[model samples]
Target: MRREIPLLITGIVGIVFVLQYFIPHFPFNRMNAWFSDWFSIVAAFAIWLGALNLMKISFQKVFRRKSDWGYAVVIIMSFLLMAVVGFAEGKGFRDQGTAFDWLFQFVYTPLSATMFAILAFFVASASYRAFRARNFEATLLLLAAFLVMLGRVPTGDVLTGFMPEGMRLSAVASWIMNFPQTAGQRAIMIGIALGLVSTSLRIILGIERSHLGGGD
Candidate 1:
């Protein structure tokens, strides 16, 4: 029963949204907006549920001595600390004064920047792994990727001293980004759109209920 009700509701909501792209009538538009607002409220409740699940899982890990559970402790602590400071201080970010502001600006911002900066290293590592030459196609992909990366920086100009006239270095880079690259991106987007449509049709018709908990 717990699983069935939510699945039914989700199916109905997904169908309505899919219809909305084709039907631009007032009823569809209004219904879509109301449904979106309702979804947002429900999403907030789901966030609370997620926070509860996180706390439970982290506590279980601490009890069992799972590998690197201390990191989970840090994750849970950071969320709780931010929640406490935000609520206990005042209302929205506007009213949230001095100390909270300092914490948000300095502490949270620096940690977030550093965390995202670490992703550059991971991206470089992944590019290395993915760029290995196994065949002609793979070699071409690797070469193109190297060109794109080089063209993003001053390195391209240094290496390609024969850069053509009337095309500034940045303009050459912009052409690479805008023309063939964007066309490829558009093609990929079209494929993604089709996949989304098929998956959504499946969900709307009750072919997918995996998001619901195991049935009792």
Candidate 2:
């Protein structure tokens, strides 16, 4: 009954949402907004549940003196510090002068920026490998990427100054982006929309029960 109830609820909610898009009148019109509110309420509870679960694992690690337990201690302290500050400040927690705002700007922002900066190196390394011309298709990709990158910079225009206006690298790059890139992007988006419809129908029909935490 436990799993059956959830599956029934899922099927009903999915059907209602799908119908609400096409039959936007009377009860269906209001159901979208009504369900959205319920979704937000559920999400608020989910956030609390997630925080509790995180603290539970962190506490267990600290009690066992596990390797890297010091990091868990830091996590607990940071979580508590932010939560306390936000609660104490109440409605003004996110205001410019508030401690929560200060911590987010000075500490969180810098940490996030540093993480992304580190990731930049990995991105560049991956780009280098992808841009390598090992085959005909790869060679075409490499040339397209090179032209696009060069076109965005002033150096490209300067280097191609002797060439005719339409025959310049920048013109070639713009054509590739507007025609080839846009077409590819549209094709990918269509494929994604089709996949989403299939998966959604499967879930609505209860054919995909993976969300229930086990295979059928």
Candidate 3:
């Protein structure tokens, strides 16, 4: 019964949204807008659900004194601290000079930046391995990466000054980005769209029920 009900709702909502895209009539458009607004309200509730789940797991870890429980304690405390500041300050909590804003700007942003900076080194190492000229395809990829990197700097432009303006490295880079990059991006987007449609169909047909939880 639980699975059937979810599948029925999924099928109905999926069909409605699919039709709404093609049929731009009054009722369809209005219904789509209404659903979107409802989605926002549902999202707020989902956030609270996520926070509660986090708290529950963190508290369990801390109480059990599991490995890395200190981090779990920190997570719970941070969540509570943020919630307290946000509630105490109300709507103005997000404005500059508020405790929430200061923590986000000084603490959150810097930590995020540090994480990304660390990731850059790992990405560089992976790229080096991937770009090794082991075969024709790999060699071609290596050359393309080199050209793109070189074209992004002033040195490449200066070195290629003798060539015609359109044939310069930077000009070639611009052309490659505008045409090849955009085409590749569109192909990926199309694949993602098709995948989403397939997954939605599976859920609507009750073939996928993982979202309803395990041991079904």
Clashes of 2: 0
Ranking by TM-score: 2, 3, 1
Estimated TM-score per prediction?
0.74, 0.92, 0.83
Question: What is each predicted model's overall lDDT from 0 to 1?
Answer: 0.79, 0.93, 0.89
TM-score of model number 3: 0.83
Tell me the alpha-carbon RMSD of every candidate. Answer: 3.8, 1.7, 2.7
lDDT accuracy of residue 202 in candidate 2: 91
* lDDT against true structure, model 2: 0.93
Q: Write the per-residue lDDT of candidate 3 for residues 53-118, one digit (tens) a residue.
A: 999999999999999999998998888888898899998899989999998999889999999899
Total backbone collisions for each predicted model = 0, 0, 0
**Which residue pairs does candidate 3 place in steric collision?**
none
Query: lDDT tens string, model 2, 1-216?
Result: 877888899999999999998996889999989998999999998998999999999999999999999999999999999999999999989999899999999999999999989998998999999999999999999999999999878888889989998878788889999999999999999999999999999998899998899876
Report how far off residue 25 is in candidate 1 (Å): 3.6
Question: What's the distance in Å from true for residue 62, model 1?
Answer: 3.6
